[model samples]
Target: MKPTIVFDLDGTLALGDGPISAYARAIATRIGDDSFGERATVALIAHAAGETSYRDGYHAVATLAAEDRVSAEIVSAAYDDSRALLGTAGATVSPPEGLSGFLHGIVEHASLVLATNAPDAGVTALLEEWAIIDLFDAMHFQVGKPAGLVPILTAALARGRVLSVGDIHEFDLAPAAELGADTALVGPAAARLEVPATMRGRTIADIYERISGWATSAPHTAS
Candidate 1:
């Protein structure tokens, strides 16, 4: 069986600050605070310093919005709206450089899966727009991670070796690591966090060549 490679959509494959900034705007509008952007930046700094448990800038804004007494219902609405705006001028998003070519290059060697906590709001459109939609063998959205990732990894493990790639350690890599899958950590968090991952990169592009190596070198005998 071909090896399985599970990816986190938002921060991993999806690059650029546009979409997340839109999320900040949504939160700010809901919470009646124009300072959310600044606060979210500070929260991200604190996260890098280990002073906060927020996973990323998005998490920071969500937590701060909740702390500002915004209802969970409102927060959910804001998030949904933000995602719906993805790829638009309000929430522009892009894939890493040469992402389409890379995925195509590795298709014969590995099975690609997209697993993200985000709803399907605009993900499909974005992938289709990028012209990489057909590259994936499966795309699973709203995949509540960490715990929710257990079953995805379990099934992949039964087939062959698995590689999970994403930005957040706790939400993306931790569960996959626990299940004995290799992991590739991505984004700025890669600079500070000591995670249990087989590979680390400040951006997915940083490890693309290495990932190509892993994909091509697969023994295809793990199962």
Candidate 2:
């Protein structure tokens, strides 16, 4: 049996907006005015001012949802709409060379999965649009990665070994580490995050090369 590999979407699979930023702009527009750009900027500024928690920065925009500027229904609609936007928003981005091939290769060697915090329906649409839905065997949704790391690892290990990869170590790798799963950190560390000495995981700057190695070594096949 091959290892099970759990991957993060956003900055991990493709370059795109962070979770907070994606909803921030949309929620702002629905609340303030028809001008999404301007309203988003204002909400972002307020968030930077420490008016709200970073994870719920969109809440700052939601506050304005009570205004007569737009109906609450419109504001609620923005949540799903914004998530769909993240799918096509990063099209011009140049994926790491051979990234698709790497992902395909990895899928062959392991049980591949997408584990992200994104709302399920929206992220599914995005991955389908990217034409990478087949590369993964499963997809885990909102609030699943950090704390859910143990279950993922346990299930994956039932078949073989497990490797967890993601953009934010604080949100992705720390919890995986607690379960003693191998880890790969994709992006920069948070300002307040501490790096553990003798970390069991590896830091990977290139997702393609890493997945390629895993693919070539495992025993799996993909459509």
Best by lDDT: 1
- For model 1, name the residue pairs that clash: none
Model 2 lDDT per residue over 1-223, tens place:
7677788766566553344455655665555645654565576565444353433334445665554465677776876776665545422222344566666656767788877776675566666666678788888877555676567667777776666777566666677667666666554332223555112222233445545565456322211
Cα lDDT tens digits for candidate 1, 33-148: 88976777677667645566567768877888877787888888888888889889998878888888888888888999999998898888899998889989998888888888
lDDT of 2: 0.58
User: Model 1 Cα displacement at 181 (Å)?
Assistant: 0.7
Indicate the TM-score of model 1. Answer: 0.90
Q: For each candidate, what TM-score against the reference?
A: 0.90, 0.65
Report the alpha-carbon TM-score of model 2 versus the true structure: 0.65
- Candidate 2 at 152: error in angstroms? 2.1
lDDT of 2 at 76: 62
Q: How many clashing pairs per prediction, in order? A: 0, 2
